[model samples]
Target: MAQYSPQYEMNRYINHYFTSHACPPQETQAWFSTPYAMMNYCQQNRIGAILPERFLQAMGIAKGYCELEPPLRLPCYLVYKKDNPKYATIQVFVDYIRRVYHIKK
Candidate 1:
């Protein structure tokens, strides 16, 4: 499996998924920091990739990559200063994000 290096936030979750699953161990064929590069490589080489939904959307599904069923669920959290004076704007942004992702904070 292809492994991403350079330590992006998603890398932690990807690592966790691999370690927790019974799938074959990931032997790094290439280290890609960005989703585009990894998606391109996977497409050209006929290899499977673990990519985020945003990346897949950006790359276009017409590339003929089959999305596995029951998408990988990664836990996420939104954190902010509770005592900050500009809490309203933060709350609005947080609410927008929750709506987009369909998640509760």
Candidate 2:
């Protein structure tokens, strides 16, 4: 179990899950700040990493990692300042993203 920054939501989720699941010390041996670093470490060490599914897809090696039972889901959100003047442009961009990703508000 490689550790990422405590600030990232994914890291928080991973930490919470691991605390309840009680991973062995051997499994929780490394720490890194980015997905790329974690992925590279896992590859070189022949270990598994708890990474965003998209990361694996982006690396073109989704099949390389062994996925565990009971997959994790992370919630995503789009946020902006309510007082911003570029509301229309932001809405258009948001709409484009939703359409591209098939997301519903």
For each of the candidates, give the backbone clash count: 0, 1
State each model's C-alpha RMSD to the native: 3.3, 3.2
lDDT (C-alpha) at residue 15 in model 2: 66
In candidate 1, stretches whose alpha carbon ends up further than 4 angstroms from where it belongs are 77-90, 100-102
On the 0 to 100 scale, the lDDT of residue 10 in model 1 is 76
> What C-alpha lDDT, on a 0 to 100 scale, does residue 32 get in candidate 2?
84
Residue 36 displacement in candidate 1 (angstroms): 1.5
Q: Tens digits of per-residue lDDT for model 1 on 2-96?
A: 65774777777777666677656667788888777888888788576788766677657655666645467877677788998989999998889
lDDT of 1: 0.74
All candidates: TM-score: 0.65, 0.69
For residue 3, give model 1's deviation from the true position in Å. 2.3
lDDT at 51 for candidate 2? 84
Q: Which candidate is the best by lDDT?
A: 2
CA lDDT of each candidate? 0.74, 0.77
TM-score of the candidate numbered 2?
A: 0.69
17 in model 2: Cα distance from truth in Å?
A: 3.0
